[model samples]
Target: MKIAVVGATGLVGRKIINLCEKYFDSDVDYSFFASSKSAGSELEINGNKIIVQELNDDNISNFNISLFSAGGEKSKLFAKKFLDKGSFVIDNSSAFRMMEDVPLVVHGINEEIITEKTMLISNPNCTTMGLVMALKPLHDEFTLKSIFPTSYQAVSGSGTKAVTSLEEEIGLGDDLTPDYSDGFYERPIAKNVIPLAGTLLENGYSDEEMKFVNESRKILSIQNLIVEPSNARVGVKTGHGTFCSALFENNVDVDEAINLISKFEGIEYWADRLATPLDAEGQNDVLVSRLRKGLSNDKILNFWVVSDNLLKGAALNAVQIAKHVSTL
Candidate 1:
């Protein structure tokens, strides 16, 4: 079988390429594609050097699956092309995520929605991927009512450019000036936090914030679920952290909630210490900690979650979806 890794030169795309070797059989053939600028550049896969091809109509070919992480625009342009070629498109972009016909999947949370008939799958936002992983097990046991989540997302979510920008800005330590000349973020992000993560809508919520609301509801299959989202971009490089205050229909036992998260698939629970972004840097599982009852009600629970934004949040989940569909 053959597989295509679209956006192969990108941050998440590279992760997907690295993971393809781990998840797929060694015999499977792999092709890498990037933009014209990155095309002709070489990348190593399974110890063999492969030239990155330009993602265009001429390069498009029949493959069992195509993993996409370029951007929404690229996905919108190229995904259907792959689908028409009888390939399953696992997209890691905002494109087609909320579409009724497309399934927005988080690996362990809602992967069962994928079937033999499924071809196009959308991976959730990096922040939502971490948030929902911690919430799903608790939501199943207690019936989630509402969630107020504040995300401390890393600059890596914006891709390699943002990561470089953060590093460059950090080199100017204590400059205390907003310089938009280098970074992908609107404001300075070296040692400061940007209040908004995505384009702000008329409703005063960012597109990233609403992704937490809409994608969580869609993935969890709770149409009326309430989500109050506030997302911020932090100075970290890899992991995305979220602080969630959730209310459930039933009273939650702190012990039981901790136990539930501990045993849940793709999650690691820390009982004695809080999980930090640095701790979650290379982890495949969502790191969850600080579980406790809310001050006001026993039915409310508060916790912190962290995950490698590039891994479980984007590329890892996309590859996992492809692996699952390959089995089907």
Candidate 2:
């Protein structure tokens, strides 16, 4: 199989390259594609030096599959170009995710929706990816009435620059000045919490928060699923934690829910230990812990979920989508 990775210079892009070497068999061939400024550079993978090429109209047909982690604008502009050239574009951006015709997919949860003929696949937001994985098995049996989620997201989700901002402001304990340079936040991220993650849209919900609601609805195939989410940017460098209090249609027990959740393929459920963001870093499974009864409602329950935003949430999901395609 011939694979190409757009945005090869970015963090998620690098992770995807690493997975190709880790997951794919020795028959796989890779072509790294990035912007013109990074065209002449090289990306080292599995002891091999792969030259990065400039992404353009002329070179779109060079692979059987292309993984894109550039932002939404870049995916909007170029994803279909790869498809037009017979490449399965597994976009890791939000660009095509919400489109009605486009299939928004996670590997084990909703992967059956795609086949060899599926030309374009949209990867869910990193937070949404982890949240839905935990929600699926429960929703499948008890049927979810509603979801209330609050996320403690790592700075790395905002990109490499946001990671730098957190590193740069580590010792600025009391300096409250805004660090709006390359970071998503308009305020200091070190020792401080920003209530926002993505840009605030017209509806007053930050784009990242809305992703939890929208993507959850689609992947679960529940058109009317209700979700209320709050996304925050924490100082941590990786992993995203989602704390959700849910209401089900039936009265449920914690042990029963854990058993159902354990039956799901991509989630690891533990009742004895608390799952932290750090626990999920560099790993592929969504970790579920802190399960308990919710207040004020017999049908309600609360649980904590965590996963590596860059790995299981983004890069691994994209690679798994391609792996499904490979089976076709």
Candidate 3:
């Protein structure tokens, strides 16, 4: 199979290229794409340096499989063009996720939903991916009624610039603080936490918060499921951690739910301990721990979930979808 990776110079995009080279069969052909500024640059993939190609409609039309990690604007303009050229698209951006026709997939959870007809598959946001992996099994055992989630996301999710900003600030030592530059983040992301993720919606929730609410429902096939989310940027580097309090339609037994979550694909359960962002960094599986029963209703349950935003949230999930589609 021939594959093209869009936004090849960016953080998630580069990771996708590396993963494809490392995991995919040696017979597969790989191409990399970036903006005009990054074109002609060389990127090493699987011990070989590959030149980055400039992204254009013509180049997009030539690839067999295109994995897009560029922002939504780029995806909105070129995704259909690639699909029109007989290429399967697994997009990591938020472009076509909620479209009625697009399937937002997490490999272990919804691989069965993919088919040859699924020419365009959407990968959910990093935060939503981690939460759903932990919630899906419980939702299956006892239908989910509502969820209140608060996310502490890492700086890496913001991109390479944000990661550099954090590292630069941390290098300034404890006495001297680094100032926020307009190019990096809206506010200082070095040692502090920012209460916003994406832009604020008319409904007063941030776009990142709404993504968790909407994308979770779409991926889990739970319509009319009420979700309240608060997304914040933390000082961490890679993982995204979420705390969720949920109410289920049927009474949920704590022990049973814990067991079910442990067996859930792409989830690791730690009943007696906690799953921290540091523990989840660089790992693909979503980690769940600190289970608690709601005070008022036995149907209510609470837990902490964490996963690598770049892996489960982006590249790994996109690659898994490609693998799933190849099998069909």
Estimated TM-score for each candidate: 0.98, 0.95, 0.95
User: Which portions of model 1 show Cα errors greater than 4 Å?
Assistant: 179-182
Among all windows of 10 consecutive residues in model 3, the one with the lowest summed lDDT is 175-184
> Candidate 1's residue-wise lDDT over 80-184, tens digit each?
999999999999999999999899999888888988888999999999999999999999999999999999999999988888889898888876487555567
Q: Which pairs clash in model 1?
A: none
Scored against the true structure, residue 37 in model 1 reaches a CA lDDT of 97
**Lowest summed-lDDT stretch of 10 residues in model 2?**
175-184
Candidate 3 matches the true fold with a TM-score of 0.95
lDDT of candidate model 1 versus the reference: 0.92
What is the per-residue lDDT of model 2 for residues 184-271, given as tens digits with 9 covering 90 to 100? 4677777777798888999999999999998999999988888999999888889999899989898878888999888888899977
By TM-score, the candidates rank as 1, 2, 3
Report the Cα RMSD per candidate: 1.1, 1.8, 1.7
On lDDT, the candidate that comes out on top is 1
Model 1 RMSD in angstroms: 1.1
Model 3 C-alpha lDDT per residue in residues 146-256, reported as the tens digit of each score: 999999999999888789878887776574344545426777676788898878889999999999888998888888999989999988898999999999999999999
